[model samples]
Target: MKMRKARTPIIGKLPLRKGTIGFRLFLYTEASKRSAEVKKYAKASRIIIYFIDRSPHLVTGNNIELISLQFLHRQSFTEKIEQLSEEYDILAIVGTVQFEYNDIPYFSLIDIFNDDHLKKLNSIICKDEPYSEMIQTLENHLTMVPSVSRLVQRLRKVIVNLELQLNVNLKEDIVIGMILHMAFLVENMKLQQPGRIFPNMEEYYNSHKEEIAKVKEVLKDIEIEYDIKLTDGEIAYICQMCLENQQL
Candidate 1:
């Protein structure tokens, strides 16, 4: 799609492209002072967020880098559109009022600016109803701060695709729940949360060794890619989750 002029009260719509990321978020702001809370929502929602600059060529001056590495991410006017062109999709405006044109889910961001807003954002990001599509969304959307990255999200896509290719019969809810639990487990492990070890979990791990091993093998690349190790406990927990729900 070509770059078109953005009318007043409009965030520039991203050009439609092949393989655009699932969601793109634009934050309307005065000058360049954007709330840090917006970034949190972006990562959790796995949506790219742009701090719409007052000047066309303004650049963000902060250390929020890794999360903003993609298009619609904070950048100068010069590089922003180029990066946006490379990645993004149907532009949706989110703010304080419900001014929507066409079919975009426009909302007033001010209305949902608290924890409630984050919850709303998460729901929007995972709007796909089918289990398969939800799996894809979870893959793109799961982010637990400095712990999880695009690498982990990408791993979700690869794993889900491989499972389908292998003809693994799994329900949508199970996959969705599994992804949420697994992501939570990893995040908790990274934080060294209490009760990290499951009681008698070792026995379960031993009995399901083969299944656990397979998952570990499949996830070996994630370890390398993210430079993080899944502790035996975390692996055991995941194995228990995956094995209990299916005849793997």
Candidate 2:
């Protein structure tokens, strides 16, 4: 008798686009004069400069490619912050050297934007910041091995917890928000343990088979909501093998 196998369900692929990730740097300077020098070296595919003051605001154009040295230190940091309330296609934040202010640090705001741009924003911001090494380590973990199943499971848990804590229903925004938040959390985690050994693709999969299977189930339910269909059986096979290996 042929053994009946579970028919793997087909689901849609998660959308990923450039600029989905972003980094926000808070540089600490005695005054705008000293901060100007640091800003001069900043470069990326996209760039923005803002002063961190009572209210943050954008001082540079959205399309500018290179860091605007002229805009640096021209206005007080407080003035730049005022502009932060305005929305942009890309992520925005006041440039600063200090990571914290008055004993309060900025919480991870990765959930603020769409997925396609979020990753790109994270990469550009991290590369240009003083914490480049730290950021690099974080990136390494996030990019180490792509296990969509594990990623989906972990993300689901995070979004659920976030919803509970915030007392706000973010069901509509959970998927994209979770992806960005996971990237940031992973980055920050690696920064805390630069020498940490990130789980290998095989290892991660083997350890999380059950969780991954559940993710597959969820994906089937939400397949239509995504932009691409993920009907690849190979991916599911790999995830299963990883989980099986972990048990041995």
Candidate 3:
């Protein structure tokens, strides 16, 4: 039998132009902010790259370079944001730090990552592009990693049960986001490493006990099936995702 070489996984590739005649998006992250935002943007940036898929018309080349400034400089940066907005004809701002620009459209870090909300961003960036199809392609590329693909399938079942118990339908994007988070989380647990620690989780869990309990029940089977356990903080984070979906 002949041996076949394994193909490398597709991560994502950046576009080829600079601040040219196309939609410009500013990804802002503060130096003093939580590392989580930085990490989130890293994931988001990769997704954006997948979205572009080397298309020339989606986003300018410089879009990948994050804008990092100090918190104290925010007051002065308002004028700067306006300048960049005019200079680049920036269509939208997506970032961790909130900007005070009243004229420009701004989407928080969370908004750009979600499927339902990403549509809003898509409309702004490129209306002709098929949003759902692009997202599906993105998911397909991400799941090329064998572990992520397996975990995503398992997490989908857990999320479906969660929706039934909560009586709330999560959008495709939210479901995908939850699955990705859970997949990585389980991977972490399998390695005997602690996942993200939700700050003041005790108080948060106490206040939202009823909601968290439902999430716990839905997740119990998955934990046993995977032969791993979820930390309280991790469960609380999952509970928060459910609550957010409910609100939507």
Candidate 4:
């Protein structure tokens, strides 16, 4: 008798290409004197802040580099855009109203500036809900910078405590929580210095073995219930792989 061959499962390709959403932000001020004034204050304070949540991918690369040159000596916005367009594949440009500068609030920049221009910028940069939410969240949170760090620390502690109380394994919930925590921290760090190193999963796990073991045990129970044959590490790795693929 002839044996039947098992059919291979076909994987569907994702529609979005990797790195296609890449963008560069150009902050175009009106004049040289104004640009110099802004730069001087920014340097002295060592804090360049915006309410908009600019993507780290764009801010760290050639996008910022080209814009910085134009802003350094007060070149025209047109010149800055020209230079940036030449260097990178600019997906969009956004114009943000400086509602606050160095903690001094300015409420009328949006009204004073060209609303149509701002709208055009918004149309280009605004892609997904997450992107819009991130920007709005950043803007709201910027006003509370005095409590931001402490608030984040407290939230992380609360999440960790909840994980313990729920008897949720550190390898799964705790590790995932820490990953999110680190991502936030990295994003904060990048606001100051672009392209800073972020925390690694292996390093985080190695430092918290006891917690990881607890997570592993809980995951084991879950695996048994689901009839999944994967080890804890394998499960985590698969999750990460799936997330990475989805982002592309």
Candidates' C-alpha lDDT: 0.43, 0.33, 0.57, 0.35
* Model 4: per-residue Cα lDDT at residue 17: 38
lDDT of 3 by residue, 132-181 (tens): 34445545545323334334434655665566456566766686678767
What TM-score does each of the candidates earn? 0.38, 0.20, 0.41, 0.23
Candidate 2 on 1-248: residue-level lDDT in tens? 12122122221122223333222233222223565554443531123322222112211111212212123443554444434212211122223332222111222332323343333233223322233333345445565323333333334433333332222343233334445544444434334533223346457557656655554543442233222233334235423332333311
Ranking by TM-score: 3, 1, 4, 2
Top TM-score hit: 3
lDDT of 4: 0.35
Clashes of each: 5, 42, 0, 2
- Runs in model 2 deviating more than 4 A are 1-75, 87-90, 94-96, 99-248
Residue 119 Cα positional deviation in candidate 2, in Å, after optimal superposition? 3.7
Model 4: how far residue 122 lies from native, Å: 3.5
Q: Considering only N, C-alpha and C atoms within 3 Å, which residue pairs clash in candidate 4?
A: 169-215, 170-215
Q: Can you write out model 4's per-residue Cα lDDT over 152-210, one digit (the tens) per residue? A: 32333333332432333233333334434433533453355333332475775576556
Positional deviation of residue 99's Cα in model 1 after best superposition, in angstroms: 49
lDDT score, candidate 4, position 121: 33
Descending-lDDT candidate ranking: 3, 1, 4, 2
TM-score of model number 3? 0.41
